[model samples]
Target: MSSAHITFDTTGDKIARRVRKMRSSAVRDLFAAATRDDVISLSGGMPAVSLLPVEDVRAATLAAVESPEARAVSLQYGPTNGAPGLRAVLADMMRDLGIRVKPDQILVTTGAQEALSLIAEAFIDPGDIIITEGPTYLGALQAFSAFEPDVRAIPFDDEGMRMDLLEEELKRIGKGNPRLKYCYVIPNFQNPGGVTMVAERRRRLLELAREYDFMVVEDDPYGRLRYDGGHQVPLKAMDENVIYLGTISKMLGPGLRTGWIAAPESVLARINLVKQGADLCGSSFDQIIVEHYFKDIPWQKTLQKFVAVYKERRDTMLAALEEFFPPEATWTHPEGGMFLWITLPDYMDTDSMLAEALEAGVTYVPGNSFFPDGKTGRNSMRVNFSFETPESITEAIRRLAKVIEDRLELYRVFIEAGALPGYDRKEAAMTDEKTPTPWEEVVADSEQNEEAVMQAREGNAEQIDIAEEAVRDAQQAAAPAEEAAE
Candidate 1:
């Protein structure tokens, strides 16, 4: 069916090197597998549409269509900077996150995806250096990769990206590549990882950005979806040099395709110019619809419902992982959001596991695709728990664990039979004769984490001081209660 030698000439505007350099995202292909009846996908980072405040959106839509002013807004082309009322609403929302921005600073886009794409078009030059979390959002990677930027990933822990490693990366940027542009971060309930950068790190990161003089793109589509509790300050809140990208997709409806970016005037202007070519402006109809939706909809009530549903799902997934997953397979316990990251033993390849997982009627996004550098997260995978039911979560994890068990067993058998290299193929194999039992390895990891926690407690004298101060304040307020108890 294939010819060995074929000469074909293609002439009309050949693919540019920058476009050619970019690769199709591995995660994008996941949707096809996800749609199958056999597969219970933990792969897609999609919010459940059934959970959205559809009635509220419908009410707003009817009101918008009926009103003369709103009808005009829907019919006519709007400004590139977005509708004025929506911009004001967005500014108010930003104030809650401690980001003070005016209407002029906000440029609305089709979605957060477009905001990132336009930013990449505006700012990233070929061979420019950009930084992101080691296991970052795949959408961002796809957006920025098209610009042919030399992307580097900073290491991340449960607390978020390692600031120490980020500092070192910043130091290398100008020396290694003079056109070094900016860093992108998802500070709260980060995609794939589900780790929130603590408040202290947010301040410290701003300090580092100021010191380095490189921009920080704070991409926060899911910050508002924090199911556990209180708000974390956006990185842009502390730094004027940062660009804040936000979306209503998670909370409202992705069908609206509404997202916005808050940045300094200069950057906003440049992004607008880039926006001129890409759809000219985000749909005027959608913008007006959203503005009306925000006005008519009681978002607080919708938010409460979302919190309750997602929290239940989160609890269900965590319980399932505990019950079914092997002790060696480590997973993050996210307080909020759709995803949790899992790390298998160093010998496991998530990409290879994905094929087996699909065959077993379960699916997950391979973690390596999240990393700016492709090979770093070979042992990890991202799981989405928010979209599935409790029973589905239980069944999916059971299947996944069976797949992993079978793979490990097969690996052992291959080595024993001499079908695989005899304990020395370090390049292609992660497992060898020395691999420990799953239970023992996971137990050891747990102990190590406990020890680390104890060590941190011992070292952190300031934490104790703060706790003591809080106790003193509480005692003073509750003196009458103390006396009654005595």
Candidate 2:
């Protein structure tokens, strides 16, 4: 068959400019790669659906779908304000968080993703300033980018975003930009970096927002998934002015696509306008399912199941990190949530390392995609511990550590020759002083180059060898008999 020549319009300046300027999000593309079965993905902030209360949800949904009343809500159109029963339950849940919001203040959206987009559509004008953490939620960044907001990023430390830096940025913006709409934060159990903001910092942040006369958009989907200890109150609990975002995607399941935003009545009104224009309203069927799921089913039991399962996964990831990462790497210890942040030496780039790690048979989200300003965090990566089995976490972390060690060694050579200035020198310095190894550093580098590491087995590498032996045994058992025999 002769090929048909296709003609395309390439002359329209506006369309060409728009097409050239707009690009698909890096995170979205990364998610596509994460779906590969061969890829041990520590990327994408995905909850382990294997642990979801699926059976209960399914049963609740079946009951709801079977009921004549449920059939009407499920089959017919739903209110833009969401199902009244669901709204009432959500309002009560909000009250538990110390927000005395009524059901009228709630807007149910498809997901927190839709909630963010609606909020941006309602509040963010072109050229308006919206501050975010240095490494914030990629989904939020993508959602706000559509509105052409001038996004500003403030650096964050372990305690969360430095209030001093935020205050300084606020003052600087005040000098020129008074059209600051809001500051977005994931104060409890943040995505990509599982650091929780201290309660005092939450208070200080609200104080800053009040002083600056700006809104605080608190996106909290992971707070309810805490594994290790006493629960921390959400930042929204501390401020009546805060716009609170909550999702069942993590707790129940993402397939439900159910999430709600608790905001001031004025903001809720605006959000409703934007939301109505978007999807009309979230799934009426899903809203009814959620309500019945909460009412008829024992939600407390389901939540407990999630807590117990995810806590095990979290511990597994921590143990794997201790067994595989290089000595020069450091990672966050999350109290709750699916992600943990890893910071490599300055000379390492996580984007480059991602290619190498994937080639070596693992995957992680590069840190650059999370930055609103796209300025720093290149030498970092975000790993999700909630999706894969403990075995997968171990293998992924091990491969990643090898990649990091090789990169660091290459950088060390350049540094020794004075070609790289910012490379870490403390590794050599500590040896010169014969200082005791930091337990933290040891935990970071458990997956150094196996050959070189074997030689240094006298220096804590022995423990790694023992773990490797166990992995070998496990792999051997799973291998085909013919291959195993060979």
Candidate 3:
């Protein structure tokens, strides 16, 4: 809720209005469970860091500090923007994507995550509006929410963010509205929702940006990790003014934490000033290592190895989904991305099922993490293939499938007892209605059929091992979702 709309009573110290708007990353919260050996985590888009040879990593670090002069440069504080030679190397890398930018225009950020926060700080003010894909990146939402912008999410199809929908939204907001700031998009292999923005949508989006008078921010972290399919043209390649964010986090290694932003000099200048205050400068040590890694070695061959492994894992997950998931469930088959999205039945409520999933020995990010409201995408979840083995990926899907089936079976029990307003089990499963079953009514109705519900469960030998407690938890969790829909 916006602080402007209501006075939230704080217990002790007053929290900043901007801080109150901030949201924690849900994926980060899953790490505790992900660390457990018993759980198969399909939560993070973690790169396969194991694919890189240990010797290569050691060589990169040693090369960065090979001599006294190199050590001095690596350890000491460097330029606020970045080391010029490092920026030059990043520029040459960008050239591969058909983007031309001078090293002077590129501002090296701690990581693309820092670039996200810096952009928000520089451009967004309270009540300002920014556009993103309907289910955009969770990290980006966390960064933007701190500034309290009205994040308008435009829905996307397989080709990507619907330009027609964007046009309609723009008209509704009015052309040249000063409140409308910039549009943020991950053009290739988008996070959470693994659909790429097609070339036609790209051209139309840029054209609309000019007509509407707002800048475009392109965050391309997954562009280089393509498993198969040809690359789509980057937004920055078409427009010189677009703010382009790139990183070595996916390719070289996330531990390096190095990324850069290329924008118009005016915009870069403002962000550079903001960056200096955030951290004196990003680790000069990390920057030195990144420079040596990309500039000194054959990085492309290692990236191909990463791609091949990801492709096999992706195939494994896809086959598992087809074999195990229910008919009511559907998923995205991405051409080249680390994660795929699974959308369950309208009433399945993925957020409400997370507890059950944890108990089932697999963890996934409920789709609510991707949206600003945190409750709108309750029927979907994001699954990752880049972090786990092919065997683990297959087993994780099987476990996840059981969780979905358990929920569906519970709903069927309610319908059978006249607790839910559906004709039968098949009708209820296929229903497109958004309204959830009434909690109070279902509880009241369940008393009379408690014996029958239990009996039905005991008779089904193949049912997932969802205990009474798990079933109750799922049903109770829906109350808040019911309120959100209202």
lDDT on C-alpha atoms for all candidate structures: 0.78, 0.77, 0.85
lDDT per residue, candidate 3, 1-486, as tens digits?
A: 665775666653677878866777888999999999899999988998989978778888997799999899999998989988899999999999999999999999989999999999999998999999989999999999989999999888889999999999999989879999999998888898888999999999999999998889999999988876788889999999999999998898888989899998999999988998999688889998898888988999999899899999999999999899877677888888799888865555787678889999999999989988887777789999998999999999999999889877865655544444333434454556444333332333332344444444467533323444444666687679989999
Ranking by lDDT: 3, 1, 2
Which prediction has more favorable lDDT, 1 or 2? 1
lDDT of 2 by residue, 89-128 (tens): 8887767566688888888889889999899999988789
TM-score of 2: 0.84
Kindly report which residue stretches of model 3 are placed more than 4 angstroms away from their true locations once superposed.
1-11, 414-486
Q: Please name the candidate that would achieve the greatest lDDT relative to the true structure.
A: 3
Worst 10-residue lDDT window for candidate 2 reads 442-451
User: Worst lDDT window (10 residues) for model 3?
Assistant: 438-447
> How does residue 323 of candidate 3 score in lDDT?
91
* Candidate 3 clashing pairs, residues 3+ apart or interchain: none
Ranking by TM-score: 3, 2, 1
Query: What TM-score would every model get versus the actual structure?
Result: 0.82, 0.84, 0.85
Worst 10 residues of 1 by lDDT: 419-428
Better of 1 and 3 by lDDT: 3
